[model samples]
Target chain A: MAQGNFILREKEYLALQASLKKLLANSYAKVVFLVDKNGSLIASAGATGDFDTTSLASLTAGNIAATGGLASLIGEKEFSILFHEGERDNMHISVVANRIILVVIFDRRSSVGLVRLRVRRTATELERILRDIDAGAGKEEEGDFEELTEADIESLLK
Target chain B: MSFINYSSREINCKIVYYGPGLCGKTTNLQYIYRRTNPESRGKMISLTTDTERTLFFDFLPLSLGEVRGFKTRFHLYTVPGQVFYDASRRLILRGVDGVVFSADSQLTRMDANVESLENLQVNLREQGYDSDRIPLVMQYNKRDLPHVASVAELHALLNYRNVPEFEAVATTGVGVFETLKAIIKLILIDLKKGGR
Candidate 1:
């Protein structure tokens, strides 16, 4: 039917929500949330009900993509931080395991200083968690080139 | 004569629309097709299953105006989002210059979004394209639905790193162009920076 269809299992959602809640509690930011690389809403806490997380997710992914490209221009291997600040609200974006993006949205209710402080530690932990998932997925081993049957190729070509 | 003809004025880049199954990935392409001028777009091709779901891929070629005397053409593709179709997704992602991730907006689709996003990363890594370094854009589709999660909630769960994210309703073409423009602009700028 529809393309890019994603169905979130309850267990994963609970875990994501719990992790987000925990992350938010550690910071004074009035709003703390998360969105997928495709701009889908996963789990969030604080000021989340007010905005379109899906739209924000799309924008966040775009931001990371641009920054990552910028990183390469500088001869860097990867891009990490996409942090920005405004007069009233500040945003910080980081890449975690190259899979999911970790975003922190804070306002004057929480200083940019505090968001940055929490982001540093949270990003590391998020990376580790994603790494664990990767290890468990059994696709971690390199060079997984499956020989394609002619039928398979034909099917794709069609 | 060069076999590949890379020195030609026209530069072609591949952009893939990737995500989990039924996440409105195809809808994004369809909306783009409907809105684009017939002269500016090629015939839309879809390889689908017996049930008519896109079993393999969807392809659309678009001309994104001209730059520096060379026409910039983008071949947009969407991989089958089903979990079992990982191989196909990988194959499609190869040689891609940019990506637009079309995430489903429903609350229940959260895990699938995360899993598919991870899949994109793994596949990209396997192909020697670092996901973190590629020009990627995110689109949370189906924003017109009522059961969708709030943007704050989504940001907390999916956007811990705060990437360029967008809100879209693919069926109606809302925010689709914005998403495409953002990724294309990013890719073009990257090429310019690389002196390509």
Candidate 2:
């Protein structure tokens, strides 16, 4: 067990990977990434080298969290989706299962309408998989994690 | 929450530096970002105001080698410490694996320190994390200041559970890594216990 553990077992991982891949195929987005509400990168598929995916995941969670705050201020239950459009890139972020967030980054090649349409279909499937994953993970998320050698942890320091 | 990427062989943990406004929470992250090798650290991002006050948070992504085959990545963040930013503070604590309360050592700021500590507990509770059980550390910062609270006094007010505490002059880097290591060590121990 590491800190902030969000365990996705093999079954869940495959399902998430497949869902992401499917989303990318059906949509015109450059990347389809999934992030936990805590800003942890769950699964990110498609090309994502324009920016660090890890950083993107963290900031996305923060963005969603901040937006949730704004929603509270406005007396809304929650803002389930966020859209940020840039000159060169556009992003669509949707809250999935109230626990995870799905982000679709697109370029001029795609329209928000198409992305939203595909996302609407994929989101329901993603949510179903997520519920199953949570139920399956239980408390044994890292039950098989072996104790690490000293050299292993020390290597990161260097 | 810790995100495990078996495919990438990585484990990501979030640790938040929390305290009253201007309590050197951001300073600690800047020191760490400065000291860490660029290869092992991501770009430090600060969401700040025109006055450079941390408007949202200061994030520094650090990769501290690996455990077993998994790279241990720690995302260190500092909440907007001003009291008025309570909403943002609670948001930052959502998946916190550990906390470092950077209490200002100035006697005049004692009230702010105490308030921030209480706020941390309340915020953590809102996120379903027990402050007592979480891996938490305290750093009495700005110890070099002329008028500062005594370690005993600060401890009495802040370290209610008597967790590992340190004296820090964050500007000069004193006691920064020591406090960080203490909390990281605690987090690793908890992780070994399956994060119970």
Candidate 3:
């Protein structure tokens, strides 16, 4: 991938993590995994604890991709959320925009129903955020990268 | 007519095994990997975190028989069945073709199963897919374990809509192929009807 594409993807990744943190607020989740459209782990939140978010993010992307295909087969358009229940914990996976995914893990304390409901609303919000970011990127193309001084890159590094 | 033109007339479709954490979603994939012919499948890749939990995803691409001059391909994936990973799950669901809802058939897990199913519905809807219309198959996995709920009981709670459902013991490979074949069939049949 070109440096420009890499930078954009990285930016998209960071944005997704920030968005996930905001959505998971008050949810009491242990960890949050964010993946790209191709099922690559872009970012994660909460405790590293005992789980691996990178692998989980990739797998989650693969799962959703397959699920989306399945949805199309049945004459549907896309896939939104997938939930799995366990004795001690539960998993909630939701699709955000067309390029990112959100994975939430919670225990008995949190209600799966509540998470599911919250996820639906968050998906819509995340979509809007992504659209805004894309628009901003477009606007920046007009003398954007050319205008950035060495100071800007240095500040970003800081 | 050859619909997919990129590859060797091989129609590669993705299938996701989704369920709650530890509900045998991974088990289903493991069983398939163990039993499938090596020549027909690619190397199984599982990405994990520092502690070795599935972080990004698990991928296993399998080659099934040809259909209408297309070599049937199925890439199976399992989400990090943990709750906090919703973002990752959403990303993985892009361009999916079929799904296997691996439910833990334990009496104690009844509520979780219901909640998970509903979550599936909501997630599918967000991606513009109606849960009722997707090519979905249900697998009540972990039947070998004691204290697990019976098939009938699970059906009563999770199968209210009456989609294709199967009883599975993922650890022993029981119902694994049945579940896989069922979903694959659904995808192929769907393609034939939709003219995709």
- Write candidate 3's Cα lDDT for B132-195 as tens digits: 7667999998787789887888888888778799988888888988888888777665554442
Residue-by-residue lDDT tens digits, candidate 1, A62-115: 456556556776899777767788887788787766656788887777766677
Displacement of the residue A158 alpha carbon in candidate 3, Å: 60
Error of 1 at B78 (Å): 0.2
The segments of candidate 3 whose C-alpha lies over 4 angstroms from its true place after superposition are A1-158, B1-3, B50-52
DockQ-based class of model 2: acceptable
Candidate 2, residues B1-196, lDDT tens digits: the string is 6777665677888899999999999999999999888998998889999999999999998888767767788989999999998999999988888899999999999999999999988888888887788889999999999999999999999899999999999999999999988887767767766745
Candidate 2 achieves a global lDDT of: 0.86
Can you give the TM-score per candidate against the true fold?
0.54, 0.93, 0.56
**Interface RMSD, model 2, angstroms:** 3.4
lDDT of 2 at A72: 89
- Give the Cα lDDT of each candidate: 0.67, 0.86, 0.68
Choose 1 or 2, whichever is better by TM-score.
Answer: 2
lDDT (10s digit) by residue, model 3, range A90-132: 8999877666788889888788887887677667767776675
Overall local distance difference test of candidate 3: 0.68
Candidate 3 docking class: incorrect
